[model samples]
Target: MILPKNNYLKARNFILTNARMIERRLFEFHFENGTSEGVFHAVYAYRNSDGGFGHGMEPDTASPESQPLFGIMALETLDEVGYLTKEIILKDFMPYFKSITTEKGGIPWMFRPKSEYPCEEHFKTVKEWAAISTTAPLLGILEKYEIDIPWMKKAEQFVWSEFERIKEKHVFCYLCVSRWLTFLEHTKSQDKAKKTINNLKNWISNNGIICEDKTDEGWGLYGKPHGLNYAPSTKSILFSLFSKMTMESDIKELISRQKDDGRWDTWYGISEGTKLEWAGIQTLWVLKVLNNYGRIQY
Candidate 1:
């Protein structure tokens, strides 16, 4: 597994130079042989006054108020770095989600924050709905940690029931489907995992239209569907069916896409004032995936 060392260095340096302290420390823990203690502090630093995550750790939104979803984001990041089973992620966060959860037992996909919170403008206006994106990954985190919390059981049932209903016909949202793939990677329901990925692929065949930019047969695509960075290619639409997501082109593109200073750019940065944060996240995300797959060693 050959890595683009120079580019990897540049990406790491970009995180150090551009990211907030929490993100910066966490980046170090992943790339620089830094301490798990650093990860713990960094993960907790984003905890808002109300005990859930806020202050922008999620990167997509900039809410200062505590958000239930962001708590999962924080825990997921910690999970990425091997900080498993922190009570902070569950005890405090479960209540937040439970409060905002729909009657159907799913968290509102878009929990709109109060206007005063620093946020991405797009999130402020997003329509709320129950979604696999909100519930599925969180369940994956709980299952991975083997945490037997009561609320998680309810959420899991909700997610499975929803997927069962859509087993035959569904609209694939690249946004949620990508995360759903992550959940499936860690889920216990192996049979359901098989069924769900197939449904996702079928959704593409049904709804996808020809687009110059989209990969994966031009379905399940969003953002720069044509750009190499955003394109999933033929391998990606049904990528959920496979455990590993990298292709040779994915490695090459990961190398090629790094900016001169080392950060990866994102579509979010184009419209949001928080480009630095999102790009930092993008860089870290690309590095994590590449590193995990043995495409990059740095």
Candidate 2:
């Protein structure tokens, strides 16, 4: 089941040549024993004076302006490299979170980027509304470090209440469910988290959030996450929801999807400017997941 050495090398070359500096550093950190500081320095390049991130850190938009989505991506990168420290959270991040937060204490999924920046057309359509999609994961990551800021109380309240209200048909984005699971994983209320997770498992089982058939071309429907995208590893709470055969089929199909250039296909639309950048990011993620499943050899 190991990813062949040649395949790994091709992906390594693709990342080194085409990936953004941050993603390149991340690749090195994960596979080549590169230092976390290298990744941290690369990540810092994306930060704005407003204590937030931008400059296409997420690759969905090349906006230089600070954004909540970019901030989340930055946090995710830091978390991946084990640099999501208390000081980093407080000094580098909390202020930005405080600035963009709504009265409801949640951050919006996105803000309309200025017209000048090159971005996918979807950016123009995003509404500036608070999102459980954005807020829940942020809260979960913060709580992982036990960093209790004033902002978290309202956010925690919002996430908890929203999870309580969410129904099967009401769910649209599958990724949001992952965020909800993350919140449940770290929240102090273990009893509440367990109950909520059980409810979510039941809901997603019947909901269209998971694609059972691996061959379905619409698996990436409009760039939505796939079943494996939600549960990249066996450790994920959602992993058990899929049968062994389903997981294996999805993983086999995923490994086969790697292009001759060593990058996997993105389910979403991408502009010429972002195609390679997104590809590089997607390749790194695929390798990580394969490694997680013991499909890659050291």
Candidate 3:
């Protein structure tokens, strides 16, 4: 499958002209065949004095205050650009993570977002949001990058125990379930991982995640198409639901959705600043997903 040519180029040029530096670097690395080290360094600018990423690296938080939730975001970016390391993980971040570790050993989704940070009230005051989303991905990163930290080992225990507990827990959020499944993939087991994967698939299918809206209304809070846009993409939901047959059509529609400006737009929170950053991120994410799906021939 091929990405739209003129639209993609216009979008590319738009990104070059209007996107943030970090986003420009990501586009260069992913689409222009540029070095990932550029992304590596650009992301580092977001790194706080305490080692955790801040300065709005993830865009929504927009604070210099370091947070472990951003640690998950940072590690994801690090892995994408080939820069994950214990030195990177331990120097400032791990200590901060240790500081925030709950008595039960789980991390918080975020420590308060800075008062000046521009986002939803929910994000601003999401006190003690479940760490499952952060913890699962962080544990997966630690495992995939082979950081070998004791806290990570403990974190793994938390992940497993939490997942087991949540099995009985009702009304799971798609974000947490998605991350939990992600961690399970990186976690230490073939049989258990496979079992969890199947269960996630069944759960998603049973829960009606497949959006039936088929209209503009389906694009939820973030302008993402359908029921839940939080779990990476529709392709991901398809994977969990065992709906491989629809992937080709989904990819085609995704390609068609590329706007004439060459960017995929996301209607995020109130701030223009936040929207711009999120838009840049959406463009990079789209390119990455297309590449992963083997649709971009270049």
Candidate 4:
């Protein structure tokens, strides 16, 4: 038998082993039994800190605390391992999902006792790129759990409308581009989806390998990079993998960047006075994309 050979196997093993290090505290409610907790812990942790995952919004790490998005990473890992379940997902994870929503019907990037960030930014009042990026993954999770939110239908409508509004413009950043495309694809808006795809292709062609614009780099939102704009993580890879917009050479180049051990270098901000590796969540996301495309072997 020809076993699948590539860096993906090594990456898969690395992820599997590191997954054990995930902090159980964040997931106390979900994993009470042998049931899978979904990605809630990872999601909550990442949002609680910077708006993105990885280590301190800088380098990549494997520990759960070190890796803020560990919940989502864990969920992806469970899916890859074929251990995800519906009951545990619904009972434990869905409650938090409801909490992320604002009274205005917009989802914030993170929740704090008093306020939320990026309250003013987004395509429409209903669809914030950061919010939708965080929420889109839950749609699949929700389906499995049989938890229905009528607002989700409204959110879907908002997403479709936003796609039409933005398809003609230059698309930038991984989350906005990826989530927009994912939403369009999932909702079956083939024409709008294609337009979104083409927009990404146009961006890649004009911007070259690395997107350098301040907006694309996650600047100008709060006059800083913030957590959402860090580079070389799931958001970046997702834009490349799912949109059907990137060139083959670009795709190959991205794949080539994967280390023999299955991790990608952190290309975003480096936190001062710290040396933590911070790309685990981003790396896992890229791995998921590769797996989805059948580029990685089981």
- Candidate 2 lDDT over residue span 1-298, tens digit each: 4678888888888889988898899888988899999989998899899998888887778789888878887887888899789888888888888889998889988889875887778888988878787898899998999888788999989887777666554444665676677788999989999998888778767656666555766554333446677678999998887888877877787777778988876654357647788778788888888988888755
Q: Clashes in candidate 2: how many?
A: 0
Q: What is the C-alpha lDDT of each candidate?
A: 0.65, 0.80, 0.67, 0.42
Off by over 4 Å in 2: 169-174, 217-225, 267-270
lDDT of 3 by residue, 123-161 (tens): 765778456778888777667766776777667777777
State the lDDT of candidate 4 residue by residue for 195-245, as single tens digits: 666765665445543433423432212122221232223444334442344
Which segments of candidate 3 are over 4 A away from where they belong? Answer: 168-178, 217-241
Error of 3 at 4 (Å): 2.4
lDDT, ranked from best to worst: 2, 3, 1, 4
User: Which number leads on TM-score?
Assistant: 2
Residue 124 in candidate 4 has what lDDT? Answer: 18
Worst 10 residues of 2 by lDDT: 218-227
User: Which residue pairs in candidate 2 collide?
Assistant: none
The model with the greatest lDDT is 2
Runs of candidate 1 with Cα error greater than 4 angstroms are 1-3, 86-89, 164-175, 182-188, 201-246, 270-273
Error of 1 at 206 (Å): 7.6
lDDT of 1 by residue, 1-298 (tens): 4567777778888988887677687777866788877887877878865667777666666566676667767767777677666475567566667777777777766667775655667778866777667788877777776777777767778888888776534343455565676677668888888777776666554553223332433221243232222224333435442223335544565566668888777666433447787777777767766665566654
